[model samples]
Target: MAVSPELEGLRRIVPSRFVSFSFPNPFLGGAPNPYGDSYAGECIRVAVLDSPLPAPSVPSTVAMLVPAGRHRDWIFSTRAGHLHLLLSSTHVSRFIILGPELSAPSPRVVSCVSRPEPDPAHARLLPLLLALCPAAAFLGNARHAVPDVPLLTFHDDLLRLAPVKVVAGPVVGEMVVEDVAIDCAPGPVELRRRLRFKRMPCLVQTQVRLCPSSAAAAAASSSLLEALDGSGGLLQPEVGGSLVEPYLQAMVAGLAVIAPSVDESIQSGVRPTCLCAGVGGGSLPMSIRVGLQFNVLGVEADSVVLDVARNHFGLVEDEFLRVHVGDAIQTIEEFSRQGEADMNFSAVMVDLDSSDAMCGVSAPPLEMTHANILLSAHTILHHHGVLILNVMPPPADVSFYQGLVDVLRQVFSELYEIDVGNGENYVLIATVSPIETRVTDNSGQFLTELRKLAGDFLEHIRKI
Candidate 1:
């Protein structure tokens, strides 16, 4: 199969590093053609100018320029006129290209266009062109007519179009902390803080590594500590800061629905207070304190974990936000003994997780769910307060979940569960008093109310 003179001439001036053409197989005499008989045997080729590679005998269905490295400059240079002339003379019907680099997880389509109709040779390619880029439109016969909306809108940031080179900086700090009460293995554990990022140079993530070498640590878990913005400040709560985890968002949603008294307390010029257990990275408590304007008391069993939260995750302690480094269970009991007038809380949030994989439950440990602890947690709440728990049951562990729910029913008059839909975690909202509002009966109405109360916080919750 020799190359056609016309295609060879077009290929010579296209500035492509790789190009390949595909023609219908002649052996399949009666096979159906997706693009109809008019283009059944017509040859099609795709060219990408970025990387150097050998052309394939049979190429993929569609290949569009990704426009990275030097190719981006070429696409935007004065030579674009020559590229437009080449496109008009060739059989290619569409071109999909990305705009300047963005903070998004993946490149977003900026421009996609096809040639106008009445040209049968290009019609077969139209269906695929439209499918790949639903925003595709005809730009007369000139490829240069394609709009550059994304580029123009972000013109000021175009300087950032240069590729970011991410190099993991040296460990900023490290420490060893141990607490037997929590689920981690019984040994000295080391935590190291380092910087990591995807593409955006301004958006850097501070991650904490906990005992990466220990077998027990591997069996237990690890997590991202926090994300920071360009100004050396934590990113907005919605970006990667605050309660972006689905289960945490569900817990916030539960809090919004069951604790209406928080609003009243705020209106009366008194800040509502919440007690949060399991202060991993302190995002949960900080979100409630800053976003909802509540006075938050965070309790973590290990002081080292609290230190990591403060030193690495941007957790700050103020008059309104305080942290207690000790056993959360004991703290709850002490609060219960203090009498409601002196130490009543608007909400009690338990977000602890078990270190033992065989424990059958993933979160808030079995002890946090003990009948005594539940009673104590119920005792310290304001008369209208709510208790929110993040519980993760082993897959299809029906007996464990049902037993936990049964125990919860014994402690609270009303129990509601929000399925985070992640298959593992569920946020349980328990109230000492019954919910009287008819809106709770309707699931849609309940979500609507939650949305209203949560506002921007709801953006992180998935599946409503």
Candidate 2:
């Protein structure tokens, strides 16, 4: 992975302060981009350079030199939000560095195309301010300014861990300039930075509370979501693990559409089976409901939670119930790939939610991770399989939740939702086939498509 002379200055390195991120699960979705069509898509061409990686998908070793004209379409990731760099035409150049999210020091933009490797002795390490001279230039033409933001912070404690040499002053990298111009005004400004020492993994020190949920409800959303004033948190043992209304509504609604009355079909010798599953083994309330109605296979990442669910919540591997301990992505991928013929589950209640509100941290729940999860589910999903998702809107940005709804709509033909009694969680039900809209019975109940067996909406799911 020798640095190319042609790309001597196009390194996509981030200043030492920025940190990298890891996304969870096989939730990645492929974003196919076309390289042609008047240079609309960005896929930095590297035919001229002998680089290890290809264009569009920038490898760590390679970086690109893009022009100022096509900056708008080429700046960020083009492949379905995977966050990989894609150049519509890298003939302008191939690249790598700090990804789209974090801001990287800009390279010098010049008309001269020199391919000489400048000697380190002759190369001058510029001051922090000088390093930013070329950044705004290649960012694209409309006007002037930087292309991104500095969202990460440098903790004093983390800074203390760095080597004294790196901590004391600026660190330098080889820079070669053919032709460039940098203009700055006397206003608030930030200089390009490089790390002096290796980054360290920081510890998140925390104290465990015997209580899982706070005694009082958290007001993260609308009033309906707030925990009742007198009601202890939903998990308080005093309540014997109260039922969450949202999950119930979602599960019931999902089952009604997915595994409708087999009683009628059974008499005619066509009994449909319903197999249910939820991602996290949290409390097992959703899993238990699925098990009671039909056979269930629950997947849990945390073993302690799985053990508790088995001992206290009745989650076990039996003729009717099975639980797997692993990432839901892998489990579902396996289920989707293997054993398609014999597997017979009409409905799947997926409560496997991984959100910052519940987990204390956030990842790309909206992008590739969830998309891959849904694609995996689709592999084994019955032609008319139903998917129920427990999507809790995040406290600040709900774009991810909305994005997920859009993804589900794309995967399944028909989609329906039931607000969980709790405002925090909204259960989204999707079916591959259009749902048979329920009708009203004389008793003022939501009469399901097969009303001969179950009278109302609640009763319909109860019977299923």
Candidate 3:
């Protein structure tokens, strides 16, 4: 066959030095040193000559000229009745080349040339020649061999990667709950159910907006809820059956610190219980009940919010999880009056937002943090129980935050803060009984512990 333009161009620039080799005649049954003993078992490059040469009499003998070099090899062999060329640097004992026809006078030639060092003038032409060749390059020295990777596709509608039809539905229901207007909309999928709340304007006329609540029925699905006021937003999804919001995760981490006591209570034939003061869409309390296996009692000032949680966000009430439609502070005070024997809790979580922007804070209305209210909340917790509060103070308002911390200190001996890194929310964890060693003192250690607990919780829930 005539030499192609790519091969001819390569032959013109490659070095002329070569070591010729040929297979011994099979009929004679004697090994012949075709090239010489010096060239044996050495890495070499090869070039085929188009001109007729003395070919071996063997029926299927291959004759080639090799050059000494440390370079990749471009091998040409027949596979499945077709000629295939592969670029590889692997060492092999022998190679077989099969074809339909063979001749002694003239034989097909394959050229394997070493890659030349970079030259400014030839750099452009080199890539063109390589592009024309039918070969695949592979890393010979890779630590692990790459397996065949099937092409990924989104053909299945149920696949996570599949395109979703997100048609925004109209407001199916609306109601006024405690001066806050609540609207429910069924988003694209059952997993994306949404509830939007608009609270009354603050004294400064700044609109107090509440983040939307979203539910994900599927374990892998997720959605983001942008703050209507644009201060910040929430990632409202139950990821792998665990809370996705950073603030909520921080609150859950507080529960993790007292997990041993909770486990002990469960072992003693009493279910560990938690009080969630602000059950916006009931995600936090639901996660506590389902993910951590704790019985949760949730209190919300507005009954309409609870209806939204049940109708849209998958809030189901059973023996372990229940909600009360009343003032959270009043509920805490009532529980305090009942005494520890009647209604003590293992943990208490407060996630309320302040409608009064004049207070320079965005969470737990000032009344919720009053000295008396804090004392009442503290009294309703078990001795080793923890109180977790989600607070959002004005940016850089250090004095306001310090004042809030001082008030919390009056009721609890131990106080720890978890920065959610969102610039908007911080989780405060306090306990009546001091912890000997606090993991929250070190942020890295705290996060490591939270991750470990979350992993275990997710694994346990998945089994059920």
Q: Where does candidate 3 stray beyond 4 Å?
A: 1-191, 200-240, 357-361, 395-398, 437-464
Best by lDDT: 1
Worst 10 residues of 1 by lDDT: 151-160
For residues 215-240, write the lDDT of model 1, one tens digit per residue.
Answer: 44343444312111111221221212
Question: Which is the leading candidate under TM-score?
Answer: 3
How does each model score on TM-score? 0.47, 0.40, 0.48
lDDT of 2 by residue, 1-464 (tens): 22235443434432211112221211113322121122222223221122222222222222332322222222222211111222211221222222212222222221112211212201121121122222323344244343221111111211101010111112111111011111122532111111111111110101011122453433432332122222233322212122323244345555555433433443456534444444322333333433233445666555654543343333346665566666665666788778666454455566443322222112324432366777776666666677666565543354766787778767767777655454455666677676554512233221232232222334323211
Candidate 1: where are CA atoms >4 Å away? 1-242, 358-361, 395-397, 438-464
Candidate 3 per-residue lDDT over residues 372-419, each given as its tens digit: 999999999998888888887743244667778999888898787777
- Model 1 per-residue lDDT at 352: 74
Model 3 residue 324 CA deviation (Å) reads 0.4
Could you list the CA RMSD of all candidates, in the order they appear?
Answer: 19.7, 19.5, 26.2
Whole-model alpha-carbon lDDT for candidate 2:
0.35
**Which scores greater on TM-score, model 2 or model 3?**
3
